[model samples]
Each structure stands twice: as C-alpha cells, then as structure tokens.
Target: MSTPAALRALLDGRWSDLRERTRRQLGVVELPPHGLDRERHREHVLRQLRVLASAGHPSTGFPVRFGGGGDLGGSVVSFEMLGFGDLSLMVKSGVQWGLFGGAVQALGTERHHERYLREIIELDLLGCFAMTESGHGSDVQHLRTTATYDAAAGEFVVHTPEPSARKDYIGNAARDGQVAVVFAQLVTDGGEHGVHALVVPIREPDGSPCAGVSIEDCGEKAGLNGVDNGRLSFDNVRVPREALLDRYGHVAEDGTYSSPVDGANKRFFTMLGTLVRGRISVAGGALSAAKKALTIAVRHGETRRQFTRPGGGEEVPILDYLVHQRRLLPALATTYALHFAQEELVSTLHEVLGGESDVDDRRQRELESRAAGLKAVATWHTTRTIQECREACGGAGYLAENQLPQLKADTDVFTTFEGDNTVLLQLVAKGLLTGYRDHVGDLDALGMARFVATQFVGVVIERTAARPLIERLVGAVSGDDLHDRGWQLKLFEDREEHVLDGLVRRLRAAGDGDAFEVFNDAQDHVLRAARVHVERIVLEAFVAAIDRCPDTEAAELLERVCDLHVLSAIEADAAWFLGHGRLTPARAKSVTGAVNRLCKLLRPHAATLVEAFAVPTEWITAPIAQR
Candidate 1:
C-alpha cells in the first residue's frame, strides 16, 4: 500500500532535491511536438539547449570556482532526467555539455578550462566530442587523424588523412558546434605518440566551417532528427600548440613530448580513463529511457482492456492477464534493480573523479570496468525493454502520439554508441581475467588473451556493495530456496565465477597460437562472463538499497520486486543453470513458476512500481497512459 510519492522518494536516492527541481523546470520548458521537419526539429532542439543553459542545467557537475554548482551527482542526475522528454534534446544536451564540456573539464588543463568552460556552460560556445570515427568507433587507440607538431611555426597541424578518419555521427558538428575536442594521433620531434585530444575550432562566429575544416550533415535518419548529427574532416587545420588538451600528455614549445605515465599503451588508456564520465552518463540516460518506456506500457496495460474472461465477465485489463503480466512485470522489476545499480555507479563516478586528491589507478580501472559493464548491460537492457514495452501495449503503442514508437526509434542506437556493448563487455572480461592488478588501460583482445595466458592466476569474486550484509546473507543460505536473498546472491556469484574460470582456461589453452583469433572465437563466452558479472553487481546493489530503506512497508514491497527480478533473470538463463547442473531441472522449472506467481501478486501494484520512476507528467503525454 505504499504510495507512489513514497516509492518515488525511495527511488530518488542521493540527488532527490535536484531531480525534483529538474522535473519542475523540465515541465515548464515546453518541448517541440513530434513530427517537425528535420531542420525545424533541429532548430527547436538547439533553442531548447539554450533554454537549458539559461536555466542552469549544464553547470551542476563543474567545479564551483568556475561558476558551476559543482554537484557532480546532481549534474549526472539532471542528464538522466532528460530521457523523460524528447531524446533528441537529451542527446543535444549531452553533446553540448556532457561530452563537449566534460572533455574540456576532464582532459584539458586549467588554461583550456578558464578559456572554454564558462562559454561552454553558458551556451555561448557549442562543441562536439569528436572521438568516434567512421572506421574506429570502438577502437580509439589507432585513429588515423593526426596532430603533428610544427615547432618552427609554434603550431600543430590537424588533418584527417583518410575517409575513415573523418569524425562521423558527431552531435553539434552539423549545425552549431564552434569547436571540437578532436582525438588524433599526436606526433612531435619525429616520433609518434598515441591518441590525444585537441581543442580545434571547426566553425567560425558567422556559423561557417573554419578555413581548413569540412563539415557534412549526417542527414535525417531512423530517429533523433532533432539532433543535427554530422561528419567532420580537417585538411591540415593548423592551430596553436596550446590546442592540445594536455592534462595527461603534453607537448612542450620545443616540440618535446612528455607524459607522466610511461609507455604509449598506458598513456592512451590513462587519457581515455579521464573521460569515463561520458560512458557513465550514457548508462544513466539509457536507464531513464527504459523507465519512461515501462511507465507508459505499465500504465496502458492497467487500463487497456483485452479479451474478456472465459466465463464472460468484463473485458480483462491487459496487465491482469498472466501472459501480459509475464511480459511486462518482470521487466518492470528488473528496471527497479537497474535503477539502484545506476545510482551506485553515479556515486562511484563522483567520488573517484574531480577530487583534489590523486585518483588511484586501481580504483579508476575498477570504476572504468564497472562503468563499461553497466553501460553495456544497461543500454542493451533499455533497447530490449523499450522494444518489449512497445509490443506489450499493442496497437496503441504503435502510434506516434502514444510515444512508444518514438522511444523505440530514438533509443535503437543506444546499444552501439558510448562504446559498442559487445566491445565494452569484453573490457569487463579482461579486467576480471587480469584481476585489475597491473596497468589498467589495455583492453585489446590480443593483449587480453596474452595476459590471460601468462598472468591470469584464478577467478576471484569481489563484492561490490554492502560487503558485510551480502557476505552474511550469502553465507547463511543452505538450500536453493529461491526466495532466500542469500541463495539469489550465491547463484549470481557462482555463475560469474564459473564463467570467468572457464573463460580463463579456454584462453590459456591456446598456448602460443594467434591470441587475437583465439580471443575472437571465444567472444561470446567473454561477453557472457561480463554480463553475468554485471547482473551479480546489479543484484547486490539492489539488496543493498533495500537494506537501506527505512520504511518496512517500502522495504517489503521492494523485497518482492527484487525477488521477481532475480527469478526472472534465472528463468531467462535457465538453460545455462541446468546445463551446469547448478540448478536441477525441477528447480529450474520452479523459477519460471515463481516468476509467474510474483508477476500475478504484483499485478495490482504494477502502476506504483513504474510510477516510482516519477517521470515528469508533461512528458508522459500518451493518451493511453493518461486515461
């Protein structure tokens, strides 16, 4: 009987005040309706980005000394909230602020910050995070674009030498971006350094491409037309040597390159690691999109009646039928679980980054691995969940006005961007096999395979949250009582361990063969290990959140939700459990039964579960949901 508002407060977590304030602000900021022409939508979104800046949406995460709110947690929460409205607006904001502004803050030195952060924050300056290239979306280490130093001229010549090296699908680049944080191979003193970011102007004050910069509109696509995605290429674009965002790697006036870290491999990762916030932000945003989608579907399911009962009573509400409930409720439960997991991720991102103290490399790598895994899992979940939500609401969900079609269209790209989900999960598996001990930046498959063959000692399961509580719960479990929290935690933990151990053995068996080929063949197992590890982390985070809830009423409700989430996860992978002999056939069948029972029990409360998402009412304008 917990009220929606009460559940919302529990779900709001650390930045509750900021979230509420953002919700109100977003309500007042009217969004452009669906079906605007491509240019008009892009123009409206651009205007809206300015409105967000004037309202202080972009300043929360920056340091207060530079005229920002300095609320790291609040900054990310506000970004996440954007998913409640037009996703184009969210991507635009992320481009202007999260990626463009974030790169300036994280990768650039103080001079670059002092010159750029205020303008970037105030919307006077718009920029693109030009990292993804046509050929190198996932692989950042070998970009073909070059920033070679010219010592005599006291400048760096930035050029995109090949078609594949052109910056593609860059937000802000097509229309509004004045500058770009261009990542390119840096060469100085006749020696090539690794990939580095440079602050290069792509457009002039008059809104024309700079003299040496070429821009092309990516054109309207399947979705997100409101964002003016474009491609950028430079032909010997010369800028002052100071253009380099040299916080991690520096080029002196004498054309000497120096870095605090040794080796190009470590230096490349260390530099990329500083910009981890972008990936984490994408995860948060994707989670919110999933929440919005589920809310609509669940609310529609509550009222949209389907076939009548067998005995000829009133038409049954779709949500009450077991088939319908089976479709939506388990997803609803897992969304709740991911909410807690994402909150935990944001908190970790806040503490490890932007601190006055030096960042611990081990901590940073662990954070990166977790962020990668979560981004992979969370966004992929959003893609699947949103699609499922669309289907669950039937024809009504198909209409553009009801919003599921738009949601599905816009979010389809989430799984690939912010690092491809498949590649990211491999990053997680590499960390697991390497035990995250030595230099933490190398995630190349060949490197990982070789490392596993040489250095991987064993599979170790490290607890992520509420260590003592999780340990006690896990240790006390005896039988496969699915409802017992300990047993649930154990299943997740054991699965990850088994997957990791098996993966290590498979890679090591390759001996002196081609490491890359061996790793490539076992890519599915690698992704599975990463996914299994993420699910365990997510479950532990859910358990920890429930323990922290003060209200017995709320905690009890969440307990059932968590149970549904865990059981559904097991049911989805029951084949693996039975094949591993970890779950007897009868026990596996019981999990599906338990999931159905929980869905039935929770059917009456489905509205409350999704409403806890607290998406702004103005945004959830679907008529089916409203009624």
Candidate 2:
C-alpha cells in the first residue's frame, strides 16, 4: 500500500522545502471569518499582509540585492500554497509582489529597482498593477492612457484620456496603495512609441490621493472583497522621466525615444513577456484552489454515509458508490495531472528566467505560449471542479465554515482575469498554426495569425517532458488497449494533431482573403486545438513524473491515477474522437467503461490521494470533514 507520505514526496516535487515552510507559516493565519463587513475584511487582510511582509514572505522572487531571496520558483510555489488560505490574501499578495513588484523588477532598470524595490518588498509602499481598463480588458496593446514626455520639465504627464481609459478592477488602488505601475502609451516629441509602464504615485505621504488622480472603490464584489479593487483615472499627472520602467524601451530627457527591440509591436510584447511570471503564478494558484476544493470534497465522501445497501445492514460511504466517485474521482485525477504539469511549467520558467541560458527568442515565445495555455486550462479546471465539488457535498458544503462556497466564489473570476480564457486559447492556437516553422517565433497577438499562410508545414507533436521515455512507451503500443499507457499517450497526441490539421485546412482555404474573418470563423476549432494540445502536454508531464517517483508503491498508485485522468478526458470528448475516425464506436464506448472502472478502482484511495496534497489542517475546518 502506498502511504500518503510517499505520495506527498512525489507531488511536492522540486520546492518541497518552500511548500512545507509556507504551509506552516500561513497556517498561523487561518481562513478569514465570514460576514465581516467589507471594510473590516479589508483591514483584516491588510494586517495579515503586514505580518507576512515583516517575515520576508514576499521577497522570494526579487533580486538578492533588494532584500529578496532571489528564488523565482520558490516565489511561484509559495503563491500557490497561499491558495489554501484566505483567497483575498492570495490575490492581494499577487498584486503586491507578482504584478506591481514584478513589473518593477522585470521591466525596470537599476535606477528604478534601486529606488523603490526595497520599500515595495517590505510593505512600506503598497501599489497597484494598473493595466486593465473599463473599455479595454484583454486588448492591452492599445490602451488609451498616455505618458507624454515633457522635455522642458524633464517629466512625463500620465493622463487618462477618457472615461474608458480609467484603470478598472485594480487591486490596492481603492485604498492602501501609495503608487501604481501604470501602463500607458508613451509619446516623445511628436510620435507615440507604444504602451509602456510608469511608476506614478496615487497616494501622498500622508495617505491622501495625489492632486491629479481620481480613485473610486469597485465596491463589494461577488468574491475577494478584501482585495480593495478600485478604479483610477489620471489628469495630467506628472512624474519624473526616471519613473518609466525602461528595460526594453526608453526615453531621454531631450524627448527622444528608443528601444532595444526594433519593431514597436515587438518591443511592447518583449516588455510584457518579461512579466510572464504573473500569468504562470495565476495558473499555479488556480490549481492550488482546485486541489483544496477536491481535497475537501474527497475527504467528505470518504466518511459521509449515503443511501444504504439493498439489505440496509449499514449505510455505505458515499465514496463507495460509482456515481459519487465519477463526480469527484476523475476530477481528482485531473487535479493530480495538472499539478505535475504546473510543476514542470514552474521549472521551465525558472530555467529560462533564471539566467542559466541566453534569451533565445524561440524559447521565449514557446514559454509564453505554454504559460497562456496552462493558465487557461488550469483556471477553467478550477472553476469547473469547484462547482462539482460543491455539488458533491450536498447541503453541508454550502455552509460558510465548510469553505467550498468561498472557494467557488473566490475562484470564479480566474477564468476571465489575467487574460480571458477564450482569448488565451486563441493565442495558443495561433502558435500551433504558425509557430516553430523554420525557427520563426513571435507572440504578438495581432500578428500571431499573420504567418499562418506560409509557416505551417505539419503538426510536430513535441513531448514536453521525458522525451525518450515517452517515445519508448508510445512506440511499444501494438493494439488499442485502453489501459495501456502508450495507447493513451498516442490517443491524446493523435487527437491534437488531427484538430490542428483541420484548423490549418480551414485557415489555408481562406488564403489571401480576409484572414482575420476566416480565423474568427474557425474560433471554435482554434479553442479545441489549444485545449487538446494542452491536454497532450499535461499527459506527458504526468508520465514524466511517474517515471521519476522513487517509491515503488506510490508510483503504482499514480499510474492508475494517471489512467483515470487521461481516460476521463477522452470520455468527456468522445464525440470528437468518434467524428474524427480516431476511435471506433466500440472503443468510444470502452472509453466510458474504462473511466467508470478507474473511478471505482481508485475509490478506496481517495482520501490518501487528496491527503498527498497536504493542505494545512486549519484550512479544512469543514464540519463534515472533521477528523
């Protein structure tokens, strides 16, 4: 029998020490109480924020020169752990370090970092990531906010040109923030360069709004009310030229503009790519929420008795029923699969951004593409799984203290935030069509589909992890054994290739004529391609993880769990396989049968599997889950 400890060692992966420390430290502040007024809730969260900062909890991602540990992967893993605590605190911390502070560290030069990074890390200066606007949410390249260089004054005038330009849904802006990393169009002399970030003050030393700045509370949201989300507008707000975060782009005091990146579009995107950590962080946190939700639901099912057997000698545990297992077990399997995928993603991020290698453009674009796809997949999984988990617990899961309702509400906006799930998927599809052909790589959203006419040769199913092992396993398959790991791997790969081929045909047929229109027409196909591609990546990561497990019994358990995840994914998309001729009618039916059997086979181990997630005891205060 595989012990939970053995399984936890596998799930913890590279950042085991950091994960353990975060759980212990964060457990000190239990989940916030329900029904506190928004003000009280915000105040409570702020106090906790101070406590965390005082202990250097927020410095993992920053440079060592700036009072930080300079551990980028640790920063991401730590944020993921926060998902099991008060989600409001999670979001607030993300804004403070991952976004606002991240922008400064990644985009700003030494002058910017030296002047402000220490205070930002220490919580002496709370700030906002002012990117999203009322008029433009996902369309970030054409923001209406402007930072015009005033050569005579040696300053830049940050202005919100219209109502639509006002920054909306900004955490830390409604209150507590002293500054904002505002994204705006930068104009020098007479020409507009493109959108750039400037560190502009929102609050004065005494905590009053700056003279030309307007701020309004977004007010009680459906969830995360403690985050202090608000709207902001600027009216010719002036900041010194040094305020610009000038890593990829720059402006001289004489009103001259230049950038290391050649094209205006490319330069803006290169600058944005430096901050991909925010998107990756969101994906990790979303999975953490999914894990917590699944843990709660699975624990309850193990002990909560349901309808009795036919003879009525005793009521069976809900987890023993095939139906309840179907509801939670397949989802539990997916949660495990996603956890492995996320771990691989973080490591890739660490290696690429950790300065171990040169900044190759192709690798950079690939990283961004993977980040976008995983973020979309993970967040959507979180939203869907939490709802299912809530339903699994019946009435008891709805109570305030059970944590499911709060988890459901807090994570609902994840699919839309960071970047809308739909848009992110489209970006991934665009990459599949035009990316990696002849070493050409680009990630600009508008130009993403432009090269599809010449770039796409054929589908290249590159394994993201353990390539030799995966190829060996995939090569050994002789028959369509649904339980065979090789067959499952090929199945996912074949489906993804077919989806991309069909999408390519549709787009290629519209050559030289209204390309955007045709791409839009095939939007459904595009999203499906992205989804399947991500599914393939996820399976490879899971297989690679299983190969690395040291404990024999735990690896065996994970193999079955991995089977549950892949079979369930295929079963859910049975129609596609049937229509695409990849699966016979018999095999399609067997997919469902296999999923049902796996769920039943995995039922007895539900508690052990979720226990491996090692969610802190304080966070699981659900009455039904009482130990």
Worst 10 residues of 1 by lDDT: 437-446
- Give the per-residue lDDT digits (tens) of candidate 2, residues 1-627: 357898998888899988888887886674678789999999999999988887678988889988888888889998998998889999999999999999998889899899989999999889999999999999898889999999999999999999999999999999889999999999998599989999999998988899999999999888999999999999999999999999888898798888888887677667787888989999999998998888889888888996788977788998898999999998899999999999998998888886734576777777888899999999999999999999999998898888899999999999988999899998787667775433333433224444554666777554576999889988998655888989888888888888888877777676655645766777899999999999999999999999999898898989999999988888888888888787899988888898888888888889899889998988888887776
lDDT score for residue 404 of model 1: 87
Question: In candidate 2, residue 221 scores what lDDT?
Answer: 88
Global lDDT of each candidate: 0.88, 0.87
What C-alpha lDDT does candidate 1 achieve relative to the native structure? 0.88
Number of the predicted model whose lDDT against the real structure is largest: 1
Stretches off by above 4 angstroms in model 1 are: 1-3, 441-455
Q: Write the per-residue lDDT of candidate 1 for residues 1-627, one digit (tens) a residue.
A: 356766888889889999998998897567778779999999899888888888888899988988898877678889999989999999999988888998889888899989999998999888999999999989888879999999999999999999999999999889888999999999998599889999999988899899989999999789899999999999999999989999888988999888888988888787888788888888989889899999999888888887888889899888888998888888888889988998998898889886767888888888899999999889988988988998998888899999989988898888888898899998898788888865765555667777877877777555666999999998999765789999889988999889988888887776666756888889899899999999999999999999998878788889999999999999999999999998999898888889989988899888888878988888988998895
lDDT of 2: 0.87
